[model samples]
Target: IVQTYVENTRLIWYRHFCNCTLINGKFIFGYYRLIPSYGLELIVEILLNTRLISISSTRSNTIRKRLHICQPFINKHHFEYREIIDIKTNESIYQLNLVVVSSNKDTTLIRLIENFEREVLKYPNRHQCFTLTILYFYQKNQTINQIYDLIHQLSIKYTSIIRLSIINQNQINYNRGLGRQLASKLFSNKQLLFFLDVDLIFTGQALDNIRQLMIHQLSISSCTVYFPIIFSYFSSMFNVNNRTVIDINSNIGSFSIYGYGNVVVRKQDLDKTGGWEINNHEWGNEDVNLFQRFSESSSECNVFRTVEPGLKHYYHKKMCNGIVNRERQKICYDADGVLLGSQRNMIIIPYGMSSISTIDCSSFEPYDKPISTWKTLVTNLNAAERDYVKSYLGQSLVEQCEEIEGEIDSLLDIWRDYRNETVANCTNPTIHSLAEPPVLRQRLTTEIEFFVKHI
Candidate 1:
């Protein structure tokens, strides 16, 4: 499957490593490999064509191992797995099987699947070392859907590497555990299974990392599962062109530490652990429950976890109405609010402003840091930034500062009353609600927004 795909597509632009420089028609590279031993210009052209050399069409090191927008930026999955060999190296490439779960209402399923094919499978190869299984869950009445037809087409096209399965949904809501179990059973072999979400964009290197970790450390001696932390992108509004929104300069996307669903485990362990627990608890909280089960069960699983920068969860609207419980709703709301825009962009100014002024909305009072470091409109601005702020707020910096000082007096009174109410009725935080609380930042943002708008 991999050889045929590689030959047909010629998309292995990312697999090779070359850190050489071309100077005055002379190839100057540090590393000495069998290729350099050939001593022919034709070899360089061949290497360049196969993407084995680091040289691009412009004769630059395209695959240098520095932080790149193309890399991490996520990889592999499973059940009956297949082995793929590199056509160049003649080495066996690791195969990962993907089990993607989604409901019929997930409108972006088709588009995301297309993205998965384009970004991962067809090229440099996320799917090169991976097999895919789409577990489509649908209500009995809403059985016939376009997703069905699309999956059918995919199954035919990628026959060696793809399978499409459907589960009859008795309830309107998706039972993630049930869907996973159904998919696991469909696997012919006890393959390593990746419980994947429908809306993830992964990289080939990420897949390679996953496969290497599992292939090396995974043992039936004890249960093992790989839980990779995924980076969630900000809203599409901030990225109209959607060109590499990688947070190279500043933190652009939110690193989701609470989300525990996207995971990799063996089929045997999943069965031994009694599969995913049926959670009547929180919405989209199935992964958390599963993780807990893996950690706290009778036969404890040795779960492996690492921050995978390549695994990215793209922005999408959430159905957080009756579906999510109180805690779940808050998480959903937080994710949705973040996707609406980051605090920096969401503080949209009114009237005929620059139409594109950046809001330096700093992080909230870090639970550990001193609150004085907070970036209010008044404090912490350099001289140049202060001048920019003066124009940004459409008022004198000194006058605005003076007005905000007065405004603080009124806000303190409101705060005192709120503090008393909090003292009167605050309770211990629950497990589900105990991660990163946005209370301080939320208030700070509100106050800053109000002051700026009024000014």
Candidate 2:
């Protein structure tokens, strides 16, 4: 039956490695199906073109060592167990099979069987050594049990080749930010970071394409490219001249090829200019800032995009009418409050304006540092530029001091009476209820408008 199935799916079997050519004629026919869906077509295509580099005994230790270096950024499931074949059978199997066997008697078995067949037909050729990592942000309200369930499910589906990790802002030990932080830690040792977004599912030859571009003549040292995720959206957004290469030497420009997320960096050069700043608050424009910093430091930081190999698509929902500014201010205030109250001897700037007129901290406090130190740090600026910022902060400080004094007085009064306790009540439920209706309508309207506007 196995041989017959392999024969029926000749395209997939042809690409599978090993010395199975001689044993092919010794098997029998298996039950069959007549029609297949688009999902099945994708599975077959992905299988025929994708490459998986097997973990050899000699190279396994090297990979394991690299994983250990990322230990600070990784969670418990970041290094997980992969199922090997039984000693007697000597045939390796996926955990998905065990799942199917256990639930064989269920009514949904047929659907499972079809999906399993499709999956089995996918990824027949293996060229690159790939490991899956799942990242989740640690939230105060999130339950550990729920996190464990999510990890377990992904582990089983990906055949225990998956690793799980969490990033928590409160933990000083781990830098809890976004992709750049994760990439900096993970790729410290690796020559290339290849910081792919979480939603990108490897279909086929993605790594191979990376290698080719690196060796290509037009490719520069610090070039990053992307394969398309969604067709029409990508084409319209990129203004596709087809297989066109964009030069982003000026800014950290992004590219959408074949329709997907951008491939962020060429790790070696990115590290030299400095990895992501651990100081940036909850994600908004951090990528742009990083790109600007890189461009200012190095001439090689360029972006070149290309088409996706097998037309893979990914989608993620975005925020809608959510109070992003309010949340950012809350985080900044909390961070400042904690820093001021902590025993750490470092000079804590409870409130300070950014060098570029952006808000760095929640409030502006006068710096007690030496004039010489401030002058040195604010290099590349004229004497007048320095004086202007200092003068502005001095005036702002007086206003902030008055507000703080009022707040202190108010708190003292609240301690005397219980009325202020009402202000501490939870606001999440109300915020969520208010966010839902408009958010749904807005998303639908935006998607439709995007189509209408483009077409």
Candidate 3:
């Protein structure tokens, strides 16, 4: 079947337009070059029957209008996979080989693995059809360290779901590409391979869409791969890391249009397309390199860059592993400095009152609109609004602001102290320095700005 795909590709590709090898020679006609255009339709005779698949049909027109995908930089479709969603049983055309790259003995693996079991493995379609390989960082002693100890527990708890592949190096620096490439080698070249990180949380619904796209949209002849646009959270402070935030609409994260990781591809397709760049290590540009290669106009490979719902990247303190090129270093630092999603207004209203429960972990959405009257009354108590709170709510407002000023107002100061302790706790200086103290302060200020609508 692979050889047949290669043969068909060779016959169809024009060397003047694409990277594929020529069958006999080059095509002199420019019109033939138009065959590969995104919107252009052509005949593709496949097994059992013939179907007319339109080019790049996104499920949601609303998100596409907001997505702003440049010409070919990112694949621009949002497929909800509404057809397969209701099927509690999802049997796909291919078996999924999920490679979750982990290093540094982190306890967050517990959240990741458990969430995977609850969300992805809950469906009969995935639980039976998937093989999860954890590419763990090197460890000599499992008892002393929290990260290693958790891995030990994981091996026992998820024996059915996990196959541990420990890297035999001290690995002071994280080589994401190397870890992913190594994991890929453990699987059959013909099987479907998904490269992932521990910070990602995805639902069974997302898996259904991914499988749908992988089976139907991907073709071996064109070397197609899928990079789903995941929603990335701002900070753990906004209740984003709370595993209970399952609904994508309820999520406080923004869609990362530029993120090219979280890939789903057949191992055979990956091998043919110059697999991952093993040399580009340190949590940078590794994913981007593959995306860029196929995004080119002349490339024979077809990349299905779609914004599939249900995948989420939880917040973490990120630092450029200091090994990527100057360009990626800038990209990494710029990513580190971002935080507008934590706006209080975006938090409160989006989920209505359930957000109060999600954020505090102590409340739930009420049966009635209990607080609506007072909430409306205070805001309208004279246009000046300075003395408005004292009108009805009284000392309640003053007392709460006092508590906020005394406690929550010093979030930056508290973070700085925590950063210092973590140095003693500060192993995360890059994240704490760039993402926490400054960005938290910035987010808080920005929230006030967004609320007040003033400078």
Candidate 4:
């Protein structure tokens, strides 16, 4: 029995148009050049198993429509191993060909290891061909001993997927992270590239979940943000005076959800752009970083979103490591500034009741509804309105205002005294000036960059 193995047993691709290498060394649009032309028949043959196998990383309408048009021809041929593979390894030890998805950019080894465990080892797929291989950012750390051990363990049970070099981290740039990963994934025998996040739990239906996210054009997409926990906390401590809001305008085309900690991109678009943005290293902002980059750079970055129903985010535990609670005051001031800028009506409409919540009720219900009875009763100026309301005199507004004014005044004075004490403890000449009185530093920094220039 003679068995033949084709180089591309699976075809992972994105939804958008891409340029492919032609026989004569020229480049042309892959979808446009191939779909309506003679390549359609060839694709049909691959689909039906005449002489090739067709597997895509996406389930877009473009791919679906094209596949449907060639359905009759595809149905004619029957190949033995033509399938869309969602890999999951369950037998503990299995040798498999692994494709490390990365770019010469921002993917740190720590981030890559997290991605590997979440996207690869966490899943249970035994369909891969290579004996044992690992995909990741191999530069962030010097320890390959642990990876070697994992591979050694896996090689004992399965003989298909085998170990290879750890993948490179993506090079930071504008929008080429996905493209780089695609190029790397294309070289492997298996047409699967696990695009894992630095912070994600790779449990339960990991492969299937990734496949669903791949439908929206890109290889994979994480769930939308719904549980407003992050936003709510930020608002309460940082922007207490302002309504907690998530900007929908920021995500024009890409569906913006609030809670997804990460996603797994497929291999198709990875080939075109190279990999994730290496330029963006700022924490709290990598999600939009790659998505925005790919949307602009690759004409073929068809990515999608998947919901990790019960997924856990382990990386978020470190959020409080270097943060300062005092910094939250800045957020409060900024939010108040926006509310003041928008006029007083920008206040949130009271939901259940007005007294218990900070929400203002002037914008809705009786106030807006002129014909409503509640409106008439409240605004109606009868004998009660005519009566001089000065009947209930208490502390004067000036006195009350003066009390608030004194409290704030005393608070600032105490801050000044404490600040002076802090200045004495700091011996470092470099940071000695930072201990200056808050008001004094504020005034000096505004007038000149003398301190900044020195530090």
Candidate 5:
């Protein structure tokens, strides 16, 4: 009986199932109907001869106004217009999968989720094909029932357009990078993955801008990643009169080149870069590490930065108590061997390093020193002591310490010569500008060559 039912269903599908295609400005439709012996009936229908309208051909504002005006008509007679509209023609264009990592901060998480929902509803077109996945770390501070109730309420509220999925981490950790890495694996089917911090407050206009940028990047076959030039407004920048509004205009030019507050990239690009560094936890250079890996993956992969204004970041207190301030200046170059930026005044401490107590003291703070000094200290420490430090400092810090030490030693001679030349030319420099001089290109090239050979 089961074989007979399967054969009948296959025959029906073979006869009637067809992909809707546009030919000569008209769509070809498919329709199917099946009746079984058990009084089960099924029907599939597709609107015929639909006119394909390219979203790019018309301004979004005009389309929005038209949609608003025809909303009532659309509801009254949905069938008449169903066959004439195709907002998105490319079936595999892009689908945005938003990943949010949350923890015991229930109130803040709730507020952020609510704000996102409100913004999404205001600009429905921006999130037309979007899904929200929340990775909640189970914290002892909040009861499990409370979390379930909050998730249930949210699911009911945004049931129309947004598909919401909640993932609960059985064990809680301070490492946000690890949580994001795990959450990313859940959305393997989605083309674009957007990682957003829960503290960020996004406006409707900003979301629309992001949507347009992602769509444009996806449309370009060569462009594999899209990074937005994020403008940050600290907690102090919030309007005193209205806490909800942020004054982002005041700090217009002070934008970070590699802002990770909200990162949007194709899943393939992320996969190529091995995704976020799972070993990173608390506050570290996880974003910078991922960016570097992405650049190294492919020269053909284009990274475009959107400078449009729409998103604002809110500052919060640090979760860890570490005072290891590493102030060494390192010239970091991009994938094209161009000087992108310099790393300086970095606070390098392992996640949860300060939380553990030593046997001799109630608390311990790792002494901040140069990479070379740290390497010497590590070498001099006993086996048991080194193991203890390793356990507390985590793998990321241990590897970084070793790498920095090697890099510094390898580049010491070249750096000394370059410095001497720079000092001699300082008195009678040809260029007085703040920008890097063309004469220094040789020095930078040498540094890059050294890195390629050793790194």
Candidate 6:
């Protein structure tokens, strides 16, 4: 039957067979005489009906010359396989809902959103599953129309990936934790919720890292919460004119983990813990309070502190001025800095670990004393007394206070020097001092460099 079919079709398909060679008991066609472009397809079709187990191209000049013609089809199929893999990978990625709270009309908000979108777009697979919920906590001074316009523009620009939600409220009573809880409630479809401050900008690699962490957590169970260590620092104060510039070489202590900054928790886990506490509207210790609540939640819940650097905080004066007041609220935290409440402790399950551990907040001394008394104790402590103070306050809390004190002192020194130079240049003017203005400016620049490099 095969012999008859080949003989009968030989007349019509003779040109296709003209360049044929029998290798390893299978017919290999070199080129099609009439339709060269359709040659590979025809060969593949013919082989599908035959007893051939495999296909190969010849290395001879005749076959190699026309082999280049089939390059497009080969590349096309290659991309098709890649597209399939990408789609599968994307489907596996769990949904990440980023909740951002913006109250004031800080111009930096736009930059923060842009940088976030840019970072999310870097991972196409992850971006497809990511959603951004922006909760605009309304203030009286902020222009309502301007806020609407900004929201509209962002909605249109990120129509495909981002799910934007803008909520308006009349009072200035919205805190970070409350705003995040509201945003999470607004978007119920998301599996994971990441609370992000409006002033913080995350890198693309950092986003990818968080995505992987979320995926790992999801694989274990849907009720898992992860917190990435936020790298927070004031933008170089001396170089106020240069926005978006951060000192990369600064110590890790400069980037303390603020409770409100880069926090990742499962929506289900949040629900289990009754979401973030909304009572603290003044933005003081809401994040810390919420963290303590999570720690004291049910034992099945998994909470972890990721040691990776995933988020960076931009410099803002409001944050700098509010630090002292915020730190004062930390006295409510246990000696280990965990919020005080609940005899029932929450379990912390590290990534890739089957065993679970509880946060022991019992060893630290009680924060019954006022902030002034605590400051007095810290100030009067000698080397031995300092170690004793650390034992009561916990080493982490003491180190953080010391770091903040150093930073404040450095900032005050820089401000004084800059002010003195400006006043001197303005008050005492001479022909030689005309050149002194430029010299003073140069000195200011040098001082900024020295501060960033040495500090």
Off by over 4 Å in 6: 1-93, 122-126, 144-147, 238-247, 251-253, 258-260, 318-455
lDDT of 6 by residue, 134-235 (tens): 777775656767656765776787675555555556643767767777777864544667787787777777765676677776666655666666655532
17-125 in candidate 1: lDDT tens per residue? 3233322121111111233443312111111122223345544332211111111211234235545433321222235678887876456678667766765557644
- What range of 10 consecutive residues in model 3 has the weakest lDDT sum? 61-70
| Span of ten consecutive residues with least summed lDDT in model 2 | 61-70
Best by lDDT: 1
TM-score per prediction, in order, is 0.53, 0.33, 0.54, 0.32, 0.47, 0.49
CA deviation > 4 Å runs, candidate 4: 1-144, 162-164, 167-190, 212-261, 279-287, 294-303, 316-455
lDDT of 5 by residue, 1-455 (tens): 22343345446645775332222111111112333433323222211122234555521211100000111222444454312223472343455667788776777777777777777655556555665777777755457676567667766766634444444454545567887888877765436787887866677777656655677655655445656666554323112222334554432223545565467877666776677887754355677676555444233455555554566555554432342333211111111111111111011121111111211111111122233245665666555445545544556756765665455444444445655677677885553323333444444435433433332
Overall lDDT per candidate, in order of appearance: 0.56, 0.34, 0.55, 0.33, 0.50, 0.50
lDDT of 3 by residue, 1-455 (tens): 22354455555654334433322211111111123344433222111111222455422211000111112223446434333233222333366767888766366676776776677556655665565788877555543355556556755865665677766665534478878888888877667787876888877777756765666555434466778878877654334345445545434667777788788887877777678888765657888887766554345555666565688887776666553477766566556534323434323432223343333211211122223223443344333232422332346644543443334335546665666666674455465434454565565545433433421
**Superposition error at 450 for model 6 (Å):** 18
Instruction: Sort all candidates by TM-score, best to worst.
Output: 3, 1, 6, 5, 2, 4
Give the per-residue lDDT digits (tens) of candidate 4, residues 211-287. 33333222232211111111111212112244323221111111214432244443334434444554433233344
Q: How accurate locally is residue 161 in candidate 4, as Cα lDDT from 0 to 100?
A: 42
lDDT at 256 for candidate 1? 68
The 10-residue segment with the lowest total lDDT in model 6: 341-350
Model 5 clashes, total count: 0
State which candidate, 3 or 6, has the greater lDDT. Answer: 3
**Candidate 2 on 1-455: residue-level lDDT in tens?**
33343355455545775322321221111112223331111111011112234554221111000000111333656677543322221122111111111111122323322332233334433212233443444445544564456446656766634455555534533222344456345433323344444333333354434544444412333344222232211211112122332222101112232222233344555565576556654433444455455433123444334444432322222222332577654433332222121111111111121122232221321122222222243353344433433343454543443454344334335333332343356454443223223443354334323422332
Ranking by lDDT: 1, 3, 6, 5, 2, 4
**What value does the lDDT take at residue 414 in candidate 6?**
55
RMSD, one per candidate, in order: 21.0, 26.0, 18.4, 22.8, 22.0, 23.8
